[model samples]
Target: MPTVLVIEDEPGMAAYLKTELQFEDYSVLLAYDGLEGLQVYEDNAQVDVILLDWMLPKMDGLGVLRRIRQTDDVPIIMMTARDYVSDKVAGLDYGADDYITKPFKMEELLARIRVVLRRGHERATYQVNDIQLDTKAHSAVKNGTFIQLSQREYTLLLTLIKNVNQVVSRDELLDQVWGTDYTGGTNILDVYIRHLREKIDDDDSDVIQTVRGIGYTMRTAGNDN
Candidate 1:
């Protein structure tokens, strides 16, 4: 069974989430404050995902997020009463995989958790044509040649290859690669695309293609079918 760490402070809300999640067959871990949450996460290796609250007694959600991102990439969903766009962006920018506002339906929270877990599994390692990405190793290879990638480059490549043959919109790519709260302009995406092309593409062939004003696509040559 997948384990979920619920770092919510409110007794009622925490109990409610724990009950619902347990009913869905998930093993739930509970912590009432950010400090306790971090300690629990550090001690538990089986935690598959984290449901964190923004407002807490000791440390805030963003602090916990930063600390976790320093060493682990476990998926995290920020569940808070702060519903503003800025708040959501702040959570995402801090490395949260997803964000949910309070007063949300339990069903929606369950769906989001499922989606995050699925994405984490899918990103373990992905391949397209001769290019391969092992997210576990944080490495990429093309045609048997190892290619070193910076963190952002690797994320961009992963996103493109995951959606290979499809025109991934700029916004989608940005959200997946740079997080939804990314303040950088779209040109940053173009720059990273160029960096990836240089590292992965050969003289006679290009795997990454710009779709005019739409976005970008990764596909094998002559396979436009």
Candidate 2:
């Protein structure tokens, strides 16, 4: 059964939603506020989907959504009382897979959940260089040995793996792994690259290659192609 995380602040709303999802045979996790939601998310990194409420205490749903997107593309459905087109567009721009307005039918909500889960499965199956990122398990391995990673490290590695053998610029890495709001400077990317090299490239010495001045490339060393 897929695990679904419900980040709804209202007790009644959260409980009802959880009941419905549980009836559908999904394992559920709940967070009453966005800050706690984030903590739960980081801990339950393997959650298959998130049902988020727009207005949340501690941190808003959008903030939490933005933070989660910086590290993983776990499927998300933003649940909100706000129904404006701008609200929906903003949620999508921030990486929400779908948006559902308040007072929605259980059937409609379930339909949207199925749709996002389908797409999430496609991403979960993607792999490169014998290294498979098990999105459902929230972990990765190369030739079967676990490749340990920090949250940011996993994001960076995933980005490189997704575009394997291509030159991915520092700006793109910063935007994708750290999000657009990151103000940490280019040196942070360099730091992450060094750390990743130590882990993924430790034995081979050629997994991730620096393109110098541009960014980096993920490929075997000494292969011109």
Candidate 3:
């Protein structure tokens, strides 16, 4: 059974969720406040999904979501009474995998949970040397040690690692990572490349190689193509 970490403040609602979710055969964990919830997540690495409330104490749901996304890409569903489009967009843009307004039926919530779980099962991992990137978690591991990454860094690294030795042009990376609607120079890309190098590269060698006139490529073997 998949484990779910629920971060809801109300006692009655939280208990109710625990009961219903248990009936559906899911292992459940609960935290009444955002801070406590985040701690629970950090303690339990096996948690497969999160049901985060909007108006949590100590820290709000969005704050918790942002914090978690910086290190792990765990599937998070924002549960709130606010059903506004902007609210939903903001939640998603901040790294929420799904959003459901409050007062929703248990069946619908369970269905959404199933969706995220299925997607989570589809997650993959890529490796080059000691570095590894998990598709679902959006996290990197170097020499078996966790390397926390920002969302942008994870996306950029994923793009290169997936293609391995194949050169990924700057325009392609810009469009894929920054989106087509972005109106900015490639300076940000270069800056992030530097950032990635600082974090992922060793003193003697680098996994990401610049293609000079083109873009970048990740090398698993020799420096030369």
Q: Pick the candidate with the highest TM-score.
A: 2
| Residue 160 displacement in candidate 2 (angstroms) | 0.7
Candidate 2 regions exceeding 4 Å error are 9-39, 55-73, 85-98, 105-120, 220-225
Task: Provide the lDDT at 183 for model 3.
Answer: 93
Per-residue lDDT of 1-225 in model 2, one digit per residue for the tens? 999999999999999989999999999999999989987987776798999999999889999998887557789999999789998999999999999999899999999999998766445644766677765566878778998888778888888887887999989999887667678778999999999888776564578888889998787445547
Which is the better candidate, 1 or 3, if ranked by TM-score?
3
Candidate 1: residue 146 lDDT (0-100): 88
Give RMSD to native, each candidate.
9.9, 3.8, 7.8
The lDDT for every candidate, in the order shown, is 0.85, 0.85, 0.86
lDDT for predicted candidate 3 compared with the true structure: 0.86
- Candidate 3, residues 9-49: lDDT per residue as tens digits? 99999999999999999999999998899779867767889
lDDT of 1 by residue, 94-181 (tens): 8999999889999999999999989884446678888988754567898888898776787788778878889999998887766565
Instruction: Output the lDDT of residue 37, model 3.
Output: 90
| Model 2, residue 43: C-alpha shift (Å) | 3.1
Task: Please identify which of the two predictions, 1 or 3, would achieve the higher lDDT against the true structure.
Answer: 3
Poorest 10 consecutive residues by lDDT, candidate 3: 173-182
Winner on TM-score between 2 and 3 is 2
